[model samples]
Target: MKNNLLLGITGSIAASKTEKLYNSLKDQYNIKFVSTSEGLKYLDDNFKINNNIISSWDNETGSPHIELSRWADKFVIYPATANFISKLNNGISDDILSATALMYKDSIYIAPAMHEEMYINEVTQENILELSKKHIFCGPKYGKLDIGDEGLGRLLEPDELINIIEKTKEKIIVTSGPTFENIDLVRGITNSSSGKQGRAIAYELLSKGYDVIYIHSDLINPVPHARNITYSSSDDLYQSILKNIKDVKKIYMTSAVSDFIPEKFNKKMSRESGELFLKLSPNIDIIKTIKSQYKDIKVIGFSAQLDDNLNFEKINTKNCDYLVINNLKDNYFGSDNNKIFIIDRDKLIYESSVENKNIIAQHIVKNTTS
Candidate 1:
């Protein structure tokens, strides 16, 4: 039997997006729609009706709100407005949606959407925090919003919401982007990595219902789903991982951490323009450090090499479970396509053809888990 999913729509500009959300998940589950009185105004009139579309509590049937609450296996409020959140937090049961929320004891998911200012309001934050104790809070992600403004409070896409609702409790850590090593106030040493592959991997894990803790540099592309910890230098990345890896089951060390850093850093930009020399010092090997302490955690490391063939004998596993080797000759630094060899401690396991980073990410997850 298909799981019954009751989608509760609230008044927000993002209410219009529910049509797309419905279309995306209609086949996967048995869906029923309900909208608040104000929510109904923003929703498209042409939205296809499936089982029941309830706008009000008034009905010939005895207590439609209670009946619907009991019918659903899961209840979701997408594009949940500030007003709706406030009502839900305050135990307001005047409306059918709030009534259903009060009655339902099982899983309830909320995806909030509103103006950035409204979202950041103290009262709104308090309400959301209280509600989060029970219900699953998906996102009001940072992105473009309805009024041509950009910040947090944009509704997460339908696919992202589906991932959140179906996600598992297994914790995974993903490190991404190039770690900067400051030489002077204005200059730094970093790699050409754009962090696209790492972000793709994080999203892939999320889509498969894995809880991801993403530790990334500020310069990289943003990943919307996971809890993020930002790092600037290699030491910062190393410390962040050590601090956050308490219960992590798996680690994806994808960041291109600088191998060397200037022994002495100039506090300000250098003014003397004579021939300048820098003493370089080797940074800590993050993968080796993590595996040394947590031997049981499955670790995945990335090697960007110049050679097409990966010499497994020369590569240091350092207790890493999987190694993803890609050739710099293939020009995968900032590109969408990637060709990689998946290697284990023993031998070459799988070699992937040049394909979309997202597809490669899917393969990596599948192979690693299998």
Candidate 2:
């Protein structure tokens, strides 16, 4: 399905670039060209947008500002002028573009374009930072400026804008780090899993415009663009996945969930008081359970083993769409590097040389998705 894209153009010398931007994106998206009154001045008289422009609050159909705000899947302001940025950050909606921008409910793509001085001014910089919390930025690449002066505040090429706004987006789940199993108030069990591989996968997915939910341990820092959820125990991880399971297209089970859980002690155990005895019980088979319940959801299970021997039974038992094997003997427990074997039901789909986790992550995504 084509994405519903709303392009909000504003007063800037770079506004003239929207003519080419429109043609490149017209077919990929169901777009509406909305311009501030000043932006229209930069456009040619015979430009296609002259007939399609929606600049007023009211039209034959009713309130366009309200309609367009809700209609768009993504709102992009190409060549957003400094005045437009200030108006939006300050919540002034005297014009249609400002009104719709204030009313937008989803993530917006703001491509700022102006003179270098205006772009670097403390007020404009602060406004951009304030909006960065909820909005995505394309670029005012460092290149030629409007008045034959060059620094920053140059608009990105039309093709670059189209590339960013047209990419297909889907929600994915990535579980990372080691899951802890509590034994006492002061003691718990967790593996040396570093969470680097999962973080790398989430990073790669985010760069490709996927809506990534990174369910990880606090052992690793959160990926900047991903929605992060931290889990401490196997149950915590299970509940986190369950909470975000809806609408997710894929699940990457990369966290090292404890195999055996220790009986919980209400109070911290003391070494000087008595000899300690810990009783172990089997933990939840998270992957197996999720696959059994949501047979339609694609679940990729990760297993850390002591050897490189192929294990098809585990994959068959879990009913995973794909299985990734990590060899612990290679010292991958807490390392930034990894060597992996990707498998389907019975065949090895891909095997990688020991490499950095980021490169391994890219290969993992490439092969599994293909």
TM-score of each: 0.67, 0.64
lDDT of 2 by residue, 116-227 (tens): 7997788887787677678876666556787688655778788766656766577899999998888999779998888988877876665555678899997666654367
**Pairs in clash, predicted candidate 2:** none
Which stretches of candidate 1 lie above 4 Å from their native place? 1-5, 9-32, 35-50, 56-74, 77-167, 314-317
Write candidate 1's Cα lDDT for 102-125 as tens digits: 898885888889987998787887
On lDDT, the candidate that comes out on top is 2
lDDT, model 1, position 190: 89
Question: Each candidate: what lDDT?
Answer: 0.82, 0.83
Total clashes in model 2, counting residue pairs 3 or more apart in sequence or in different chains:
0
Supply the global lDDT for candidate 2: 0.83
lDDT of 1 at 337: 82
